[model samples]
Target: LWLPGMGAAYATAAPADPVPWRAILASWTASHVAHAVDAAAERLQADGKRAHSSQRLTQARLRQTLQRAESARTVRERRSGERQRLLAAHAAWREETHQP
Candidate 1:
C-alpha cells in the first residue's frame, strides 16, 4: 500500500510469507526520483524565460543608443554647414568693403 504524502509503501504478509521489501523500496525511490526530475525541469524552464527576457531588454537598449548617436551626428553636420555659410558671407562683406 502506498501512503499519501509519505512517499513510502508498506506490505502485509502472514508468518509463512515474507514482505516484499525490495519491491516496496524500489517503488518509493522511483517516485521520489520522478518528483525531483519534474522539479528540476520546471526550474530550467523558468530560467530560460528569464534569459530570453533579458536578451530582449539588452537589444532594445542598444537600438536606443544607436538612434541617439545618429541624431547627434545629424546635429553636428547641420551646425558645420551653418558655420561654413556664415564664414562665406563674412568674406564676401569684407571683399565689398575692401577691408584688406
Candidate 2:
C-alpha cells in the first residue's frame, strides 16, 4: 500500500506582483551613503596637504564617486533580477504548456 505522506508535492503558485521601485530606490540611496563615508576616509588618508578649497572639493568628489558607483550597481542588480524572473517565467510556461 502507498504511504499517506509519500505522495508527490504540488507545485507552488507564483506571486502576482512586480518589484517595488520605491524599495529599490531606498536601498540604492542607503548603499551610496555608506560608500560616501568610505570615500571621505580614503580622501583624508591620501592627501596630507590641504588647499583653500580642499574640503569642499573632497566632499563633492566623494559624493560624485559614490553616486556613480551606486547607480551602476543598482542598474546591474535590477537587470540581473529581471533576467532571473524572465527565466523562471519561461520555465513555468514550458511546464504548464506541456502538462497533460
Candidate 3:
C-alpha cells in the first residue's frame, strides 16, 4: 500500500512537525466532543421547531372551536326569538276570537 508519510525502505512516520501521543489523543477527544455538542444542538433546534408548530396548531383549533360555539349561540337566540313571536301571535288570536 502507498502510504503518504512512509519511505520505500521502512514504514516510519515522517511528518515535519512530530506530534506527541498525548497531543494527538487530546485533539481527537476534543473533536469528538465538539461533534457531539453540535449534534445535540441540532436536535434541540428541531424539537423547538416542532413545539412551535404544535402550539400554533393548537391555537388554530381553539379559535375554530370558539367561532363554532359563537355561531351556535346566535342560531339558538334567533330560534328562541321566533318562538316568542309565535306565542305572542297565538295569544292575540285567542283574545280576538273569544271576546268577553
Candidate 4:
C-alpha cells in the first residue's frame, strides 16, 4: 500500500504535457525578421552618406574648373592689351623715322 502511494506521488510530481513546437518556431522567425530589417536600415544609411559625399566632391570640382577658366580669360585679356600697345608704339616710331 505504501509503494503504490509512493508511485502515485512521483507521477503527480512531474508534468505529463509535452513541449510546444509552434511557440519555438514562431519565436525564431520573429528574431530573424527583426535582424533583417535592422541590417537593411544600416545599409540604406550608408548608401545615403556615400551619395552626399559624392555630390560635395562634384560641386567642388565644378567650382575649381570655373576658377581656372576665369584665370585663363584674365591672362588672355592682358596679353591682348599688351600686343595692342606694342603695335601703337611701332606705328609712332615708323612715322617719326620716315623710310624713303
Candidate 5:
C-alpha cells in the first residue's frame, strides 16, 4: 500500500515512459550533418585558394612566353635586314667588275 509523501509512494515509477528517442536521434543526425557541411566548406575554400594561385602562375608563365617570342622575332628581323644588305653589296660588286 502507498501513502502520500511516503517511501513506497515516492518510489512509484511510470507505467510507460515517454522518451522521445526518435527526436533525440534526429537531433544527433542534424548535428553530424552540420559538422559535415562545415568540413566541406573548409575544403572548398582551400581548393579555391589553390585554384587562384595556379591561375596566377599560369598568367605569369604566359607573359614570360610572350616576351621570349617577341625577343626571338626581333632577332630574326635584325638578321634578315643584315642579310639583305650583304646581298645588295655583292650584286653592286659584280656589276662594277663586269663594266670593265
Candidate 6:
C-alpha cells in the first residue's frame, strides 16, 4: 500500500501469509508523531529568536530615549543659567541708573 505524504510503498504478504497490519499502523503513527514533534520544536526555536531580537530592539530604543532626555536636560539647565545672569545684570543696571 502507498502511504500518502511519506512517498514510500508498503507491500503486503503473499496470499498465504497474513498481512502485518499492526506493524504498518505503528510505523505510520510513529512517523506522524515524530514529524509533529519536530515541527513544534522548530516553531519554539523560531519564537525564541524573535523574542530575543525584540528584547534587543527595545533596549536600544530605551537607551536612545534616555540619551535624548539627558541632552534636553542639559540644554534647559544652560538656558536657565543664562536667564539668571541676564536678570541679575538688568537689576544692577536699573539700580545704578535710578541712583540720585
Off by over 4 Å in 6: 5-19
Model 5 agreement with the true structure over 17-80: per-residue lDDT tens digits:
3644444455555666788999999999999999999999999999999999999999999999
Candidate 5: global Cα-lDDT? 0.74
Q: Which TM-score value belongs to model 3?
A: 0.74
lDDT of 3 by residue, 1-100 (tens): 3332223223232344364444445555566678899999999999999999999999999999999999999999999999999988888998999844
lDDT winner = 1
Each candidate: what lDDT?
0.79, 0.67, 0.74, 0.72, 0.74, 0.78
lDDT of 4 by residue, 1-100 (tens): 1222234344443354363334344445565678899999999999999999999999999999999999999999999999999988888888889843
Better of 4 and 6 by TM-score: 6
Model 6 lowest lDDT segment of ten: 5-14
For every model shown, the clashing-pair count is: 0, 0, 0, 0, 0, 0
Candidate 4's C-alpha lDDT? 0.72
Ranking by TM-score: 6, 1, 3, 4, 5, 2
Model 2: per-residue Cα lDDT over 1-100, one tens digit each: 2222222211121234253444444455566677899999888866645653698888999999999999999999999999999999988998989943
Residue 61's lDDT within candidate 6 is 100
Q: Best candidate per TM-score, number?
A: 6
State, as a TM-score between 0 and 1, how close model 2 is to the true structure.
0.44
Error of 1 at 31 (Å): 1.5
lDDT by residue for model 1 (1-100), tens: 5555333354432334365655566667777899999999999999999999999999999999999999999999999999999999999999999977
User: Which ten contiguous residues of candidate 1 have the minimum total lDDT?
Assistant: 5-14
Work out how many backbone clashes candidate 3 has: 0
